[model samples]
Target: MTPHEALDDLTRRGLLRSLKPLPDNRGRLVVAGETWLNFCSNDYLDLGHDPALVAASVRAVEDLGCSAAGSRLVSGHLDLHAEFEAKAAAFLGFEAALLFGSGFLANLGAVPALAGEKATIFCDRLNHASLIDGIRMSGMKWHRYRHNDPAHLDELLTKHPAEAGETRLVITDSIFSMDGDAAPLAAVAEAARRHGALLLVDESHAIGVMGPSSKGLCAAFGLKPDAITCGMGKAFGGYGGFVATSATLAALIVNRARSFIYSTGLPPACVGAGIAALDRFAETRGALGDEAMALAKRMHGLLAEAGFEMPPFASPILPVMVGDNHLAQEFAARLAARRILCSAIRPPTVPPGTARLRLTVTRAHTGADLIAARDAFAAVARELGLLP
Candidate 1:
């Protein structure tokens, strides 16, 4: 069958998915012309709609106009971008940083540029799609280890020690986005160091959520600056991504990373917003301590109490494992009907048979909100015969 026929087959099988439109109003996710309580968004801190961010964005447009207008190598580079990059690098304890328009592009740029033709990349199985794509783009032979299994990575390295001379690279997400679990970065780093391999971590989820001062997993684990590429949008509550590394590595990426070199720089508004967000993170760092973790723990407990099977993750990305795609979709739809929004994560986004309702808890949600969410899940599960 042709590719289009395969797509049609997927649609017929109720597997094809489309975007759900969201409205402009606060906390409103629009689906079928109705607003619902959003739980599927990655806006963990709920900073996406913060008044400060909005104000900063407005001021930026007023001062700097709309677009970056050209690629960074051409005329797109701006003083705002430099300031933001400098702040981000310093915050993350890196010598220098390079920004890309988006996290996806940053990965695409850095991964391939750092690892060349003869390099071999060892990647974790459950990493974000961007890292997987980056590894593929790197044109290096990549071996996938079982999710968070440092032993598998060690085995791969031991079996193929010959590839070490060709810039052996091991890559993983510091926090798995879908699972909401922290990676064992120390173990991974140890294995990398043991085999003289370089570690590349994408701390997209943990940059502003985990670690002291919202630095990231590398800081949490004391990994060197050269080990990380962070997405500013997720936890930074802003736009763009950066490769935070030593001066030499930063220079190399700036010189060779095509995505950063060729694409339009991040917008001045986004730069300002990012800078503001980073500053906010630093100022409010103490507040992120136990409250966020406590909230996540409470949600996990409530879900488990309601007999929902949650995956093992300490981060805010809580997954209620439903095991069946149709049921997962129905569960999400039922939640939506009740004005609580969640999305059914099915095949391609997650492995088959692991379809789940990926609910996120934020500082914005209260204890009562969590209870309501639990009640909703329980009601839906019981109604659907998923729970007794």
Candidate 2:
């Protein structure tokens, strides 16, 4: 289709995407020159604008310059990269960690690298797009079990046994981003163990916001996945991605993963901020995540009592399932008009009819902010005839 036709098509289908310049700080976003209470950010700990992180980034830019200069093996391997990786590995309870430009690239690289020739992959139906892309790029057939349904996964595993000269791999995202629900990692891990298959968990939305100590959901379940992929952009309040695994696996990715071998190294500024976030995460003792979850629960209760339906939420990421895309859009527009801005998520980010407003509450959101959200939601629900 021509560019004009594509634009028209998107507009016609309500699938058109638009950009809004919303500068964020302390759970508030400035959109269209008006400040709005932000419930759409992934900065769960409110550290994106943290002073320490800003200072660290500023210092790194002044001292190390911007780019890594080249790929790590080609003179970009600075002392700071090594230092950051070491710290990241230790912090995440892994033997080693290799940073990528983003979480998408990490999965896009790791999935295929782990897929041995003629491999049989078992993936979750609701895994992130990156994971699906990685599996597809591997050029191997994969079985997708029902979303977070371990019984279905076990059945699939039993039916699709590894044949001669084939390897078995199980991949999943620990936290389902759109639905704000967690995977049954304990059960999946057990299944993988029973089948003698390697497991890879993308903790993109889980790290720094889960686990007993906030290491990740894998740690909380006492499961040691063959590899854990994480993005530093969400709860970390920084930007970058990394895979934490054994030294051997790390070495293999360095040499084999095409995306990693080809892409330039991540910016030093992100590294500095990431290190600072990790340190702060250690200092807080997971209290930031705890507070965010507590507030989410409070909001869920408030909204439910007010007659607005909520998704089955296990984290700060909450979804108001509107079912219809236009209704989701309308709900968000109403909320935005009231100076409370949350995003309306639609296909293909979610299922065709599961359009929703993915409201993410952070620790920085005060009780008053939550009260505004609750009240605004009630008003919108009633106006939209969603309330009885």
Candidate 3:
């Protein structure tokens, strides 16, 4: 189709997406000259505006002068980056950790490195786009199991035909990005072991939010996967990504991952801020996580009582599924009109009929904020005819 026709189609079908600028964003979101109770940001720790983290970043800039200068293999490598990686590897219980510019780049680099051309990848159906893109780039054979279904993954691993020398990799997100559900990591590890495959997990949303002391899904299960990737941008309250693995495997990624090899390193300021953020999280691990979980439980209960249906929520992401796309947008609009901000996750992000308001709660939100949120949801549900 022509560009005009394609644009027209998207506009007519309510699929046209646009960026909404959120400036001076803290717990109260600033969007289009209005402040909103933001339930859309991934700043799970509310540290985006934390004074300590900001100070750390500024200190790094004063010392290191902003840029990393070149790719990590080149002159870009700095002592600050090395320090963070060492702390991260030790913190996550891994032999070594390699940093990347972003979580997207981490997956985009690591997936292809672990599953080269001759390997077969067993992927979770709901794995994020970056994982899928990396798998595609590898040119490796791939099979997607039903989301969070270990039995299906096991079946695929057992039945999928491959050559004798082909390696097998099982990849999934520890905490799904859109659905706010966690993959069955223990069961996945078991399946991978039985199938003689290496397990790769993306802990992007779980690293600093889930598990005791922010150790992630593997720690929660006490099962060490072959490789894991975590992002500093989410609950870490910083910017960057990391893949933790054996020292040998870490070496392999540095040598083979194209994205990492080609891109300049994340700024020194980001690394310093990341270390500070992690330190801050470790200071009060369970308290922050438990508080957020409690608030989310109340949110789920309130919405369910209001007639919204969903599976048991195990993460802070509370998706209020509204199956129709237009209705989902309307629900978001109504919430925004009430000074609440909940992003409408529509098709392409989710399945065609599974549009939702992807409401996320952070520790930064107060009890009053949550109560207001619950009331807003109830009002919107009633107006949308979503309530009984």
Give each model's whole-structure lDDT. 0.81, 0.87, 0.87
Residue 166's lDDT within candidate 2 is 84
Stretches off by above 4 angstroms in model 3 are: 30-34
Tell me the spans in candidate 1 whose CA falls farther than 4 Å from its real position. 2-4, 25-35, 163-165
Per residue, candidate 2 scores C-alpha lDDT tens digits across 10-36 of 777667889976565558766668768
Each prediction's RMSD to truth = 2.0, 1.5, 1.5
**Residue pair clashes in candidate 1:** none
**Residue 216 in candidate 3, Cα distance off native in Å:** 1.2
Writing each residue's lDDT as its tens digit, candidate 3 over 1-388 gives: 9999999887776677888776655778667777679888788877777888899999999999989999999999999989988988888889999999999999999999998668999999999999999999999889999999999998898898557888899999999999989898999999999888989999988877778886777888997999999878788778899999999889989999998999999998899898888787678775666676777777778667766786697888989888888888899999989999898898788988988999988877887888888889889988888885
Q: TM-score per candidate, in order?
A: 0.94, 0.96, 0.96
Of 1 and 3, the candidate ahead on TM-score is 3
- Clashing residue pairs in all predictions, respectively, total 0, 0, 0
RMSD (CA, Å), candidate 3 to true, equals 1.5
What's the CA error at residue 291 for candidate 2, in Å? 1.6
lDDT of 1 by residue, 79-173 (tens): 88888879888888788888888899889988887886578889999988988888888778889999999999999999988543598889999
What's the distance in Å from true for residue 203, model 1? 0.7
Q: List the residue pairs that clash in candidate 2.
A: none
